[model samples]
Every structure is written in structure tokens, then in C-alpha cells.
Target: RHDKLAVNYMAMVKLAMIQQHLRAISPSDRT
Candidate 1:
């Protein structure tokens, strides 16, 4: 159970990082 929770937490962190990266890049492209 503990391992599963850790894996889920890591996945969430990775997703957040990817989202932030995309948001950062998209604004520059718009202008």
C-alpha cells in the first residue's frame, strides 16, 4: 500500500511539472 501511494505521488508531481513547462512555452509562441 505504501509503495502504491508513493508511486501515485510521483506521477502527480511529474504531471504538474509537465503542465508548468507547457504553460511557460505556450505564451512565448503566442507573441
Candidate 2:
């Protein structure tokens, strides 16, 4: 159970990073 939670946390962090990267490349292409 703890491992599952950790995996979810990491996934969210990665997703946030990707979003930030995309915004940096195109500030006007936000959804």
C-alpha cells in the first residue's frame, strides 16, 4: 500500500514537470 502511494506521487510530480516544460515552450498553447 505504501509503495502504491509513492508511485502515484511520483507520477503526479512527473506530470507537473511535463506541463511546466510545455508551458515554457509555448505560453499561448495552454488548455
lDDT of each: 0.91, 0.94
Which candidate gets the maximum TM-score versus the true structure? 2
Error of 2 at 15 (Å): 0.2
- Kindly list the per-residue Cα lDDT of model 2 for residues 1-31, writing each as its tens digit: 6999999999999999999999999989856
Instruction: Report the C-alpha lDDT of model 1 over 1-31, residue by residue, as the tens digit.
Output: 6999999999999999998999897877666
Tell how far residue 27 is off in model 2, in angstroms. 1.7
lDDT (0-100) at residue 17 of candidate 1? 100
Stretch of 10 with least lDDT, candidate 1? 22-31
Clashes by residue pair, model 1:
none
lDDT of 1: 0.91
TM-score of candidate 1 on Cα atoms, chains taken together: 0.76
